[model samples]
Target: MHTERSAAAADRHVGDVDLTHWRSRAGRRIAGAWAALGKRYGAMPLLLLTLAVGVGIAVLATWIASEVYDAVREADDVAVLDRPVLDWALTLRSPTGDRLVTWWTDIAGTIGMPIVALGFLVGFTVQRRAWTPLVLLVAASGGSLLMTIAGKDLIGRARPPLSDAVPPYESSPSFPSGHTLNATVIVGTIVYLLLLRQSRVVTRVWTIVVGTLFVLSVGASRVFLGHHWLTDVLAAWALGLAWLALVITAHRLYLTALHRGAEPEPGALGRS
Candidate 1:
């Protein structure tokens, strides 16, 4: 009877161990599910955070422009250099420089922005049957245009004097350089969408670097050709970066939410 009791106790102990093991496994599974959900929905918070940061930088640019526009309330001695820089640019003019500047400037304007975006937009949509390219183009074009117009009007900071400006003078408020802003958005969007279809890390990196250089060169051309002040270009750069970041981040969050695990490589968006 004692031996029988021992055997029964041992069996009960084994049953308890099994029960504990299953309970632990169930607990771990519940924890893992909660973690996965948190990871998936986490982008919502990230989106809000990015939105705040981007908008904050844009508003900050406006504020800085306001301070600079107020002559008596000048924020720094930097404003003292505006005309000097313009004079230097005017002095640096040459046939070669003029040609280069004109070429670079147009690249961000009628020739480059619209053509590249539209060409890729059609290609991507036809090949992939996805509207992402179109969406990106619209966002970049519409958003940059609206922001440029609104910021210019609100700031009302006059462009450099007509005498100081290059030919085909643009008579618009110049708190933020429209060329710089538009170039950033258009070139940036193209690079981003193209990168989505690419796979080679080196190719991706090189594309980004080249695109960035183009954008920066465009901004410099504006300042060099006396179309805008250094501050105007600076403000445009900051604001444009903010807008681009917002767009890219929002798109990424959208993709993450869609549960598409593997992202397509950057290419022409053709059928794989």
Candidate 2:
């Protein structure tokens, strides 16, 4: 009986040890998976981001119909906010307000935006030595430029009438605001890429707020100055946001592939 009791105890102890070991292994596996997912999406879920991209594209489509097809849709209705918004915008006219709006517009312009974006990219790449962000910046800037040009040329939507516009008018098509699009792409990309490296919650929130405010201000300046219709600015917001989201998704996927030790092949969908 004594020998049997001792044998029973030994078996129970061995079983407990095995169970504990398995539990620990399972825990580590689960944690690692979550970590991997976090790395891939910057702590955001992949499904949610993809869904947002889809929504943005849909909104952009509505704008295209309104501007490109001249479809009767509320989204395309320049009159939607024309009278009220323009009336209100006129209230902001003054030497000081004009200066501020012009400053914002100038900074969001082609030359100004590219300088700011490339400057940040150079600094960011220098700090991290990661080819991932460099590739992302190039793609985002190039894609934004191409889209803006194509939209302007193909849509051929005329800018607001000269009577409504302030001085220094633009001659390009006005389906989408170039200043708004450039601002959203450059500011949005900068905030997204930089925020990925920021670990502090407060800092991240502040970064997003500042970026958003800047983009919105640029768009508002365009409308307030009568450069682009409100609808045009809205379309640019949707377009730029969609493009920015796509850029971020690509970057996340790049990070995930890198984490898995995948060899980035030439002429493939990934980079160094």
RMSD of each: 16.0, 14.1
Clashes of 1: 8
lDDT for position 252 in model 2? 41
Clashes of each: 8, 0
Write model 1 residue lDDT over 1-272, tens digit each, in one string.
12211211222222123211224576446334433543555423433444455455555565655555565325656567677788888888998988879887987775677887788788866755544556657766767776787678777878888877778788888878988998888788888776766657788888899999998998888888888998788778877887887777555443433232223322323342
- Checking candidate 1 for backbone clashes, the offending pairs are 196-265, 196-266, 197-265, 197-266, 197-267, 198-265, 198-266, 198-267
lDDT of 2 by residue, 50-146 (tens): 4345445634554564454456343545576666787788787988878777877889887788889889989866655444456667767766776
- Which pairs clash (backbone N, Cα, C closer than 3 Å) in model 2? none
TM-score of each: 0.70, 0.71
Can you give the lDDT of residue 197 in candidate 2?
61
- What's the lDDT of the predicted structure labeled candidate 1? 0.65
